[model samples]
Target: MNIEIVDIVNKINVILVEEFEVDEDVIEAGKNLKDTLDLDSLDYVDLVVIIESNFGVKLVESDFANVITFQDFYNLIERKILAKQQ
Candidate 1:
């Protein structure tokens, strides 16, 4: 169940575009995730749900405490995916 970062990126991009109605161009690694996506509290819930369903990685609220950038979010997902594999 090894997952590559590119796979994570592609899935995340698709999820953001389809589920969150985010513009693809704005979904950059360097951007601030919440601000770039215009996400509110409720949107975080939806994001959690989508991430769980898409990657089988259940993310808790505290997992986002240090997640400021989209790259940080991707790294979190990658770590969770690797943890799940273990």
Candidate 2:
């Protein structure tokens, strides 16, 4: 179940770019995800659905409370992916 951070980042970048129509340039590690993606509440649901489908990790609302930057989001995904392996 070992996964690279680069793989997580690449998958997320593609998901954001293709599913949310977010600009690829804005999807950086230190940038704010919500602000960069301009995601509304419904958009969050869509994001969750896409993430679940893509990563096979079921995400809850609280999972996003501390996810401000793309790095945080990537870390969360990594955690979830690893958690699922357990």
Among these predicted structures, which one has the highest TM-score?
A: 1
lDDT for each candidate structure: 0.94, 0.92
Choose the strongest candidate by lDDT.
1
Tens digits of lDDT, candidate 2, 1-86: 67888998999899899988777988889999898899899999999999999899999999999999999999999999999889
Q: Write the per-residue lDDT of candidate 1 for residues 1-86, one digit (tens) a residue.
A: 78899999999999999999888999999999999999999999999999998898889999999999999999999999999888
Reference-based lDDT, residue 42, model 2: 100
Model 2 residue pairs with clashes: none
Q: Where does the lowest 10-residue lDDT sum fall in candidate 2?
A: 19-28
lDDT of 1 at 45: 96
- How many clashing residue pairs are found in candidate 2? 0
Mark the regions of model 1 whose C-alpha exceeds 4 Å error after superposition. Answer: none
